[model samples]
Target: MFRTENALILREVRFKESDRILTALTADAGKMTLAAHGALSKHSRIAAATQQLTYAELTLFEKNGRYTVREGVTKEGFPGLRQDLGKLALGSYFAECLEQYAGEDQPEPELMQLGLNSLYALSEGLGSCEKIKAAFELRLMTLEGYAPAEESCPVCGRGDIREPVFLPEEGQTVCRACRKAGRSLPLTENALAAMRHILHAPAKKLLAFRLTEEEQSLLSAVAESWLLHCSDRNFPTLAYYRNLKL
Candidate 1:
């Protein structure tokens, strides 16, 4: 049978001679691996379509419940990202995360939109990479039911949040008094405010918000802790970001 859909290139790996195994995040299918034979050769449509970070329309054939790309048409190629190494690595990391977290046969239309929007923003918005990463992580976790709450305290039943604490293990904030007795990642008032903004800010506001360097550092650390705690794997790309100091 024929299956036609839009897809985002999540990853691709060489398969045998002149073939590549492409992993794509699609509108109807979350993630899929397809073999494109001789795809790297000149004048191959599959080669053109399978580039990472490409948003393409694919015509596929499914036999025995496996999807194979018969042909593809490029709709949007995130070329600007390719020009900047940081953007490219960041995009690749996000693509890998999308592929790793979501698997084939579980469709998420909104997540697809978020991925596209982020790539577009990388091209069009101010190069505030930290904001973009945080925004995506915030919304991605939220969509996955992990976004932290903005309440006065997310721990110990109740407390007015004069100075909230971010507990990486808990994935939320706790009151200062409540935090003293519990395991937590310590955070300052300014960092707490930044976290609040990350939790509350709408999509369009991420690139616009002005965050201090110190706040960015704190937010980055907190986010890393949260992701590491949740994903259960060290994000080497994120570690690369940490080394870049931006």
Candidate 2:
């Protein structure tokens, strides 16, 4: 059967000499692994659309539960990312996260939107890289049903946590008075406010808020730690991105 879908190419591996295998996140099919014949050849038509992080409309043929790309047209190649190594690394990290967490053969429109928005933000330089990273991490976790309770301290039921410290394992914030001995990252008031905004804001307004350098650092640390804890795996792309930043 032949069908069409809009998909983001998350990862690609060389198959044989000229063919390619792609891990794609589709708007309707969630995640799919697709085979693209001759994608590596110099004269291949679909090569550009099949590149990692390219968002494209793909014509696919499915048989025996396997998919092959018959045609592909790029929707948004995010050209700006390639010119800047930092943005490219961060964009690659986003792709890795989506490939890891998005469910296969399930519709995940919201997650798809988040991934697109994140890449667009990076490609367009819409916000500070740190801010974008923090927002994406927190929002992705929320979409996966692991949203942290930023509204109140879980232990004391206090809506106003003046001295907030985030517990990654528990996926919640607590007042310093209620903090225990496990891993906890302290949050400044600005960092806490940013976290709340990230969790509740709409897609377009996700990075609307501002933060000082110190506050951004705090938020970045919290967001990364929380996501790693919830996902229970470390991403090599994330490590590479961090190394690039350093």
Output the number of the TM-score-best candidate. Answer: 2
Instruction: State in Å the error of residue 61, model 2.
Output: 1.2
Q: Candidate 1, which ten residues in sequence have the lowest lDDT sum?
A: 154-163
Model 2 whole-model lDDT (C-alpha atoms): 0.93
Candidate 1 Cα lDDT to native = 0.75
- The C-alpha RMSD in Å for every predicted model, in order, reads 2.6, 1.0
Per-residue lDDT of candidate 1, residues 145-226 (tens digit): 7887656685566645655667777676877776755566666676666666766666656455556877776676677667
Global fold similarity of model 2 (TM-score): 0.97
Per-model TM-score, in order, reads 0.87, 0.97
Per-model C-alpha lDDT, please?
0.75, 0.93
Clashing pairs in 2: none
- Candidate 1 regions exceeding 4 Å error are 155-160, 181-194, 200-208, 240-246
